[model samples]
Target: MADAEGDRITLSALQDTQAIQGQTVILPTALGVAPVETTGDPRIEAGWFDNGLKRARKELGQADRSVGDERLPVLIVTRYLVDGTLHEDRAIYDLGFALDGQLLGGTRVRIRGLSLITRVPAASGQAKLDARWKQLHPKLAS
Candidate 1:
């Protein structure tokens, strides 16, 4: 479904995501084994505008500007969950995961690459489902 429309993340995909919701997702940094939450479209999120038109544009002709990354909105626990932390600013980072499952008779998962953009305060920042972070930390990339 790589070329599928951004909205093509179907019920099956969502259901499949939820089915693994209870599973542990480990972020190498401070964030650790947090359960999976709802997911966004598993699109090749290329740039700032992670959702629609803008990202598509980058893919079409702006390869030079494109970070060429991938993202999926996997809501995991962060410093925000804690009442207070060292930094209140939001932070973004490239991340990865190691998932053990079965696809056709067994589970098949492949990662092309990963990278980190920036990081924000644990309380207010959000984590992008980028491949960069996972690339650096293989254990994190799944």
Candidate 2:
């Protein structure tokens, strides 16, 4: 996604630091679920992207509940992986804690930073989609 200046945050820059962890990141619920909604539409072939977001949301929700507070920061990790053959795909991760209060209406969270945790090359677009699906839905991977 692009920042206020309309510049897309480079995936490389996002993974540069561990700052995003343990910090609260606020996201509109709309943007949070956009990937999932677009993927579910039969007319769109972005199911992989949608599935990944769903998985990430589930994992993050579990982690959030475990923390016992809703006010915690949310971590979001977005990436586009390109293999040696130049094939590319994108994925997003949710790694923050749960918040205690409402996140809407001018509320803002402080982002500590970002870090790269995984980098895998997929043999095809489908494979890349599967990788993201696996990330968001670990149960399916089993």
Candidate 3:
């Protein structure tokens, strides 16, 4: 959906994502009685927006002006919850700007890549999720 406040145009999308299936593997231990398992969680759902579009535009413009180019790097991190599942998503966006440092609203924002980790119900998924998230937080934040 699109909203206009004065001169700035705001765009938003909810229910715009699709769920990705997860996998779990079980391996036999050396003793042949115990099991070792590993899991890869799925992304259930996510919603993203930094509260306002005007603010984002200003920041992008400032970054472009500082670098004297429109090829500015943007990192988008989003967190959301649905039906007890927690979703964390990160994406790298390549924004296009004009020669005057104005945001090119009509230009397509290229998504270079994305990483998504989700927490879902399982025998021992929450703990593993927490530990993995903790380990990845520092790197992702930078």
In terms of TM-score, the best-performing candidate is 3
**What TM-score fits each model?**
0.23, 0.25, 0.27
lDDT of each: 0.30, 0.29, 0.29
Cα lDDT of model 2 by residue, 1-142, tens digit: 2133211222232333322112112222322433222111111122223333334545544331223312211223222223322223222233322222235532122222233334433333234433544444344221
RMSD of each: 14.2, 12.2, 16.3
Top candidate on lDDT is: 1
Q: Compared to the true structure, candidate 3 yields what TM-score?
A: 0.27
Query: How are the candidates ranked when ordered by lDDT, highest leading?
Result: 1, 2, 3
The parts of candidate 2 lying over 4 Å away from their true place are 1-94, 103-112, 122-142
Name the regions of candidate 1 deviating beyond 4 angstroms.
1-69, 73-90, 95-107, 127-142
Compared with the true structure, what per-residue lDDT tens digits does model 3 show for residues 1-142?
Answer: 1121112122222464533222222111111222212123321111112212223444333221233323222232344454557664444332322222236433222212223234234454434443442342222221
Candidate 1 TM-score over all chains jointly: 0.23
The global Cα lDDT (0 to 1) of model 1 is 0.30
